[model samples]
Target: MKKILFLFVLGVFFFVPSLSVQAAEEFLYICGPCSRNFVPIAEDVIQELALEDNVHIKLVSCLGACTASPVVEFKGEIYGHMTKEKLFALLRSYFTL
Candidate 1:
């Protein structure tokens, strides 16, 4: 029993670090009054951003910044009142070469 317990603890010690090492990338959270309002444009942004590996872009509903529809938050930077043109351009500048 003691040997089993010791091995279990050792196994956990070896495993925990790898879990934290999983890479999480920054994304632009585009929040509109409805997901439909911006998802098509958002899909374009995602496709554009996806060209660069490890960048994740997703569209969400009501990020509580809806007073400014089409809000883009990247790495905690909040941009308000986004248009598809501005958003597509801004993301390219930020996420691409």
Candidate 2:
């Protein structure tokens, strides 16, 4: 019984590290008001770049940048006046796309 318990503990230790080694996923937050225009664009970019598994798109009511209606928050940095061209450029630089 003691040997079986020791083996179980050993197995858990090896398994947990593998779970932590997975690549971190990135989150893109788009403003609700601007989602009408930006969601599709974001979806297209992710699909085109085959980043569906690594990137996630979320819609929020606001990022408190209404003047810059189409705002997006990534990696805790807020970007305003978002455009499809700019998004492509940003992602390309970060993701090596």
Candidate 3:
């Protein structure tokens, strides 16, 4: 199941010719329902990650991970229980790819 999902995402990336060209500009959206302090965390990640080359970040509303507070989405997957440091690491890794 995991492999199939991975292949599906990979297929999407490979087929989107324009997307492959500027993959870095593609966004890492940190999202969650508005509550607790998720909004601020998402905003902070956007500000920090957007400065990187070919990389952009945004704060998205309602990614259905409200129970996890901070959730991050990129390349069609979502990450929960995120922090600023974790976001930094992910951006660095994805940017390199």
| Superposed model 3: Cα runs more than 4 Å off | 1-23, 35-53
RMSD of each: 6.8, 4.3, 13.5
Candidate numbers sorted by lDDT from highest down: 2, 1, 3
Writing each residue's lDDT as its tens digit, candidate 2 over 2-52 gives: 999999999999988887855458999998875547898888988887888
Of the pair 1 and 2, which is ahead by TM-score?
A: 2
Error of 1 at 33 (Å): 5.1
Candidate 3 residue-wise lDDT, 1-97, digit = tens? 9999999999888888755554446766766354336546545655666645554556777778777757778778887887877766776687653
Best by the lDDT measure? 2
- TM-score against truth, every candidate: 0.53, 0.71, 0.53
Q: Could you tell me which 10 consecutive residues in candidate 1 have the lowest summed lDDT?
A: 48-57
Clashes of each: 0, 0, 1
Question: Alpha-carbon error at 29 in model 1, in Å?
Answer: 1.2
Candidate 1, overall lDDT? 0.68
The pairs that clash in candidate 1 are none
